[model samples]
Target: MDGTLTINGPKHTDGLTVERQEKPFHPIEHVDARLISLLDMAADSICLIDDHSRILLFNKASETLFGYSAEDVIGQRVDILMPQKYAEHHDGWIARYLETGEHSIIGIGREVQGQHKDGTTFPFDLSVGVAETENGKQFIGVMRDLRARKEDEQRLRSLQTELNQMTRINAMDEMGATVAHELNQPLTAIILYLQAVERKVSKLADRGPITSEDVEQLSDLCGRAIQEAQRSSSLLQRIRSIIEKKEPERTTCDLVEIIRKAHKLSLVGFSATDVFIDLSAPDDLPPVSVDPVQIEQIFLNLLRNAFQAMREVEQKAIKISLKIVTDEEDRRDRLQVRFQDTGSGIPDSHRKNLFKAFDSERRNGMGLGLAIARSIAQNHGGSLDLAPFDEAQPGACFLLTLPIASSPSDESEPKTESSESMDGSQ
Candidate 1:
């Protein structure tokens, strides 16, 4: 009788009828009405639940945030206000905390989605604490809606993307004269090839009979003409695609293929025949974790920088090497791309703030390329840096590191949590 809960009416427990003349204490009734009045007036959503996760007290803000009245959820399970994905986790953590006297989320603020009575979910920041009550322990949760903050972040991301596109356009503008000159070379070559083809045809007409040798020569000249035209057309198309503005889309891509494209595109103004580029990478390297177009922009920027640096040098050469590296601090695998140019090395004065924005030494240069590239790299859990100068090596060396994409086999289906919520009698 001493260990049992006292009830005024007869009640059955363990198949035995127990009668008592004592009145059962109501937690909300026993607590000071003034505390309840303060809770009702609080701005943030506040909810109190028992060990079984049943809602004991729900304030005005809680009712408004969850689209439910106090009477509707008073004796209901707390899961009613939680999204399906997080409801089970809420109960599990509570059970574990009570049994093991350990906490996974108690007194710690966490971002979680809350489900409204209309079945819509929204993000909220939750902070939970345990309070000692007359009956036992009750958990109090304070939640703040995050919709406005989330909207602000989304808008910021959009603005950043627009800025990146504009920077790329400005970089192209700086190379306007060079790109035009390069385009003229390919077009002029095509014309010369076509003229040679026409001359061969005229010679064949003058000759009495068309021999196998004559046919072969004409075929070879025509093929060369077609090749020259295709080269000009391809280069134009590549440039056009680069300047075209499009919404950013991300996809996994091969680093070697992107490097090759960027290298070809970057050599537009530079004498391709005079400048030598050597690229080497492992055949079995994993795919790069990056947005193909954004990563291509980075490659283009580094290549163009190297090409410009070697303008005065007699032998313009760039050595690009790629290899896998394991970060010692985190044990994460990354791909490192090295661009070592045989040109006048970076001056010591400009080395410290190399990636800083608007600090260009080159005439008419935007100085944003490296800064943007480094920002993009870091955003993808990677890095971009100028290799420390070595007395033995004369030219500047830029090292870019990127994460390796996870393989298809590494992905697993997401585990869904229970979607149950109970509304029991008060």
Candidate 2:
């Protein structure tokens, strides 16, 4: 609220003298006694000054804050309460405001240093306001001490640093094991293919002439071996990027391609032959603004979660669909990505803490996946949620919504992407 207080009552003759003077002193007449009482009883410091910046009135709280009695401060220049450097600029600051009617701090409050009579400076929050009086214009300042609040903020920062350190250590432990598990699949496949080549070579040495059939088989084995090697290399590179701690680099990219890559990565150690994963999206969808690596990490978490859920079931299936949610009035439409898994739906007991870190009953992980995924989504001005599971269908559905990137032209390539399906063969 502004400094000027309006109280309806008859004025009192008893008022302080701090106006036009033989020596910068003039009498303030017709001041209300109730107004004087209110200022004296205020919890925060209050000081009023005239056009010359000379103190017209000093409340009791101001006396306590500055270690100066009302008698010692009234009629003194307001600059005396601040440091010498600030005091030098005080006259000019007020002159500019009075001349141009432009405000620096008059209408806005800010933190500033206030010097006590003992020659020590302390931080205080100050807000100034101006009012027109019958005699002239007066400026009122309200200030609050900031020492206790500053100390509390410092303590909170320390605690947060400690908590972050511990979380990183714990996450590293879990992530290391996951990397080994995923790498084992491609590495093992590569080894098996190489061993088969060795056997084929040994057999060829015994046989005299090599047939075209023999060359085709060897070529096929080598190609498969190369594919497995490439898989291992790609997995390592992506995981390495994820492990490095750095500021997120946000950019616009194709969301569908990111989802496709993450789906391929998530199946690294899972039984892909027995499982059916359908990823359906529109051919022409606008790009989304996101930190590509972080967004990929989110999709990986969600896909792996679905994979883990269907591990024990004979009929396993995962369906992921992406679409645009058009709400023109909102001025920004969002991309909706939904993942559904056909397995034993989440138990009633585990639903409450599903997204909480280190709290999952069915996962081999420490349960940081969904929690981290949600955090990343929110940081990108998006959201991830577990939609209600249909008991009849017996599956869990996760919905992630992200904002589409803003383009120069309103024209979009086309369409939302859902209700359509791609076979697991891809």
Candidate 3:
């Protein structure tokens, strides 16, 4: 009876009793530390929660992303890491998933907002998975920050917008040149016919018994027609100059004379006759080496803008002042021209984009006057800017600055002459 019992495979042993015993079974832990450690080493944040939505496992990446330690979040409700609104309804969603097993966010990746320990929310990519364990069902979520990707997308959109704007500007330039060419032909013909009619009427009056009043009225009408035709032609010339790609012809000329001619020409319309112009410049000022026509055009634009701005004002005046500016070393470096108008000052909202193409505050404005004027100024080694408004003066002021030519021979290269042919009678 004291001898040990022995059992053989499918056989009985003589002179011994045999017995078989079964070993007890133990269930594995719901979370394996080794597996969690592997997930912790990943770049994306990994988190695990139990059936009750309590955080069961938090990896190193998760700790860093949520700005919390594992000890702070373990056994805590998983909703603490989500936005308040999402947290409030997250439990119901989990319950629905467990009851119906219908896929909503489970087993799918999507974009969502993640809340950090500091309570700041940021965009993230979230992918969730469900697992069944001896302890019950659990959820595993992987989160990746989207801040960098979003910034890249924003930059791309900005570049696309800039490209679109440049394309529009190029198209406008082409259209403007074509329109100017088409208009110049009809304008030239109109002027020629009007001139011929004036001559015929004069000859008829001399041979017939035409009354003095009739002759005077007819002459006045003919003169006004001719003037209007010339004005139209000049406007076309200005449009052509603005869209012209060739270098302008530069010559030595007096800036004062240019200003006077611009002042006179800008007054041709009824809207500008009531506006008085005051000019000031030093008599000993040196001649500027520039395109006289281009300079006059700049003055004309400035004066026209001033007149338009002052149309409703009781006091209508434009003050033009010129001075030679010297550098720090006392060497003559620039010429400064200031045009100040007694009119309604530019609004603060309009100041920033004042020189941008196609941006204007006037109802009948083309929005190119200031843009082209500034461009011409910059092309001539100069700048045009709205001067600071004087509180006492109560008007708008513009300053034009140009670099003085170093020498008389500092000229632009000669450009090829281009001309258009049009029949005046047609």
Among these predicted structures, which one has the highest lDDT? Answer: 1
How does residue 244 of candidate 3 score in lDDT? 51
- Note the Cα lDDT for every prediction shown: 0.77, 0.76, 0.70
Off by over 4 Å in 2: 1-227, 312-315, 326-331, 347-353, 358-367, 388-393, 407-426
Better of 1 and 2 by TM-score: 1
Model 2: which residue pairs collide? Answer: 19-26, 21-25
For residue 399, model 1's alpha carbon misses the true position, in angstroms, by 3.8
Q: For all candidates, what are the clash counts?
A: 0, 2, 0
lDDT of 2 by residue, 224-288 (tens): 99998998898778766666666668899898879877776666555556667777876556789
Indicate the worst ten consecutive residues by lDDT in candidate 3. Answer: 417-426
Candidate 3 or 2, higher lDDT:
2
In candidate 2 the C-alpha lDDT for residue 199 amounts to 97
Ranking by lDDT: 1, 2, 3
> Which lDDT tens digits does candidate 3 get at residues 1-426?
534344231112233322322112222346577787798789999888876677877889989889999989887888889898777457666655665587689878899888999999988999999899766778889888898999998896566445434533553464565555555765776677677767768887787877787667677767766776776776656545544544468887888877866665555343465666777775555577788767777887787677777878998877777776764655756888888888888878777888776785642362566776787688687789988768988778899987665433432443232222211111
List pairs with backbone clashes in candidate 3: none
Query: Cα-based RMSD of the predictions, in order?
Result: 12.6, 10.2, 23.4
Q: Return the top candidate by TM-score.
A: 1
Evaluated at residue 333, the lDDT of candidate 1 is 80
| Residue 337 CA displacement from its true place in model 3, Å | 0.6
lDDT score, residue 93, model 2? 62
